[model samples]
Target: MRGPRTQTERDDTTVEIVYAAVTGVLLAGAAFALVMSPVLFLGDVPITTLANLWRAAKITAVVVFAARICWTLRRFGRR
Candidate 1:
């Protein structure tokens, strides 16, 4: 027979579940951005120009942020 979970165990499980959910959401968002960003590009602007480079930087920042969020969430989930 299985024993009932202690309060601390229940809290830990809840925290782990939340972390997993957050990581999943972040990964999905990152994947969607990766797929859609190029399709919504700014036409008429050359890729080598400052304006296009700035757009690229913005997308890179978003991807980096999402990756970091997922990394942190996984680290916490393992605790």
Candidate 2:
């Protein structure tokens, strides 16, 4: 078993967590906007299709957010 984490290790973890969350939000927002851009740029889209696109955008945002967080943590752990 490993020993307890030192102060610097704890601080590094806190920093990494914050970094992951911030970057995740930014990346997720960008992904959501990208996915929903068709609604903004295209005219006369049907309401149903618009709703579907919105749903897809939300899903994409969530996936991107989770992925970024996991990737960041995993990469940090590997270092």
* Model 2 Cα lDDT, one tens digit per residue, 42-72: 9789999999999999999999999999999
In angstroms, give how far residue 24 of model 2 lies from its true place.
0.5
Q: What is the C-alpha lDDT of each candidate?
A: 0.66, 0.97
For the record, the alpha-carbon RMSD of candidate 1 to the native fold, in angstroms, is 7.6
TM-score leader: 2
Displacement of the residue 12 alpha carbon in candidate 2, Å: 0.1
The TM-score, computed over Cα atoms with residue i paired to residue i, of candidate 2 is 0.93
Each model's number of backbone clashes? 0, 0
Residue 46 in candidate 2, Cα distance off native in Å: 1.4
lDDT of 1 at 55: 67
* Alpha carbon lDDT at 29, candidate 1: 62
Query: Roughly what TM-score does model 1 have, to 2 decimal places?
Result: 0.50
**Residue lDDT tens for model 1, 1-79:** 8699799988987876677667656665666566445546855655567456566656775676566667776787586
Per lDDT, the best of the predicted structures is 2
Tell me how far the alpha carbon of residue 30 in candidate 1 is from the true structure, in angstroms, after superposition: 0.3
